[model samples]
Target: MKNRKHIVICEDAKTRITINRKWCKGCEICVEFCPQKTLLMEGDKAVVRDIASCNRCMLCELRCPDFAIEVSEGTGR
Candidate 1:
């Protein structure tokens, strides 16, 4: 199977967050650092549990040591 990818468009509709399950080691660093509590641990991977609650804060992306999370600004698909 291909690498699992979890993508969430923020409430603003301009920001997107992507969690690369293949790269995530499920360390929970991102989840703990997220000021908006937008991510959660699902089994051994991190997933976007709440998209609308996301505040465009890149803490998850910035704090992920595995480089598993990414936050971008654009009109997402």
Candidate 2:
């Protein structure tokens, strides 16, 4: 079985973050680059530690060298 991916959506419906565990290599770049400190490394993967502080900046997605994370902006409804 494949590892489960993680998805997080901001309450204001402005930001969505998708974490593909299968592709992630636990590089910590996403966790380190997040300006809002929304992501953290747990064991060997990235997890959403705080969604409220997320600013939808997309830095995590952009900095992910393994393409394990994606950041999207929309109404979320």
Candidate 3:
């Protein structure tokens, strides 16, 4: 008989998610507010293509005046 031991570091998967394209006004406020620099301007709107880089800070969601963004946790994608 043998016992195997393994160690792993688990990180929180909760992340900032969802972007209401129609609501977005292309103000770029969210782009500037992201401390992690997770947002980018795509065409006339801000696009959050890099979901993995997001730390769920909610800066984008909070800064959006048009209610264009929504940052939340869990697997609601």
Among these predicted structures, which one has the highest lDDT? 2
Give the runs in model 3 whose Cα sits over 4 Å from its true position: 1-13
List where candidate 1 sits over 4 angstroms from the true fold.
1-12
* Candidate closer to the true structure by TM-score (higher is better), 2 or 3: 2
Per-residue CA lDDT of model 3 for 1-77, tens digit only, reads 14222111112366646666666778999998899888889898787656678887777777789987777675533
TM-score of each: 0.78, 0.78, 0.74
TM-score of 3: 0.74
lDDT of residue 25 for candidate 2? 92
The lDDT, on a scale of 0 to 1, for candidate 3 is 0.70
Candidates, ranked, TM-score: 2, 1, 3
Which is better, 1 or 3, measured by TM-score?
Answer: 1
State the number of backbone clashes in model 3.
0
Q: Model 3: how large is the Cα RMSD against the reference? A: 13.4
lDDT of 3 at 70: 76
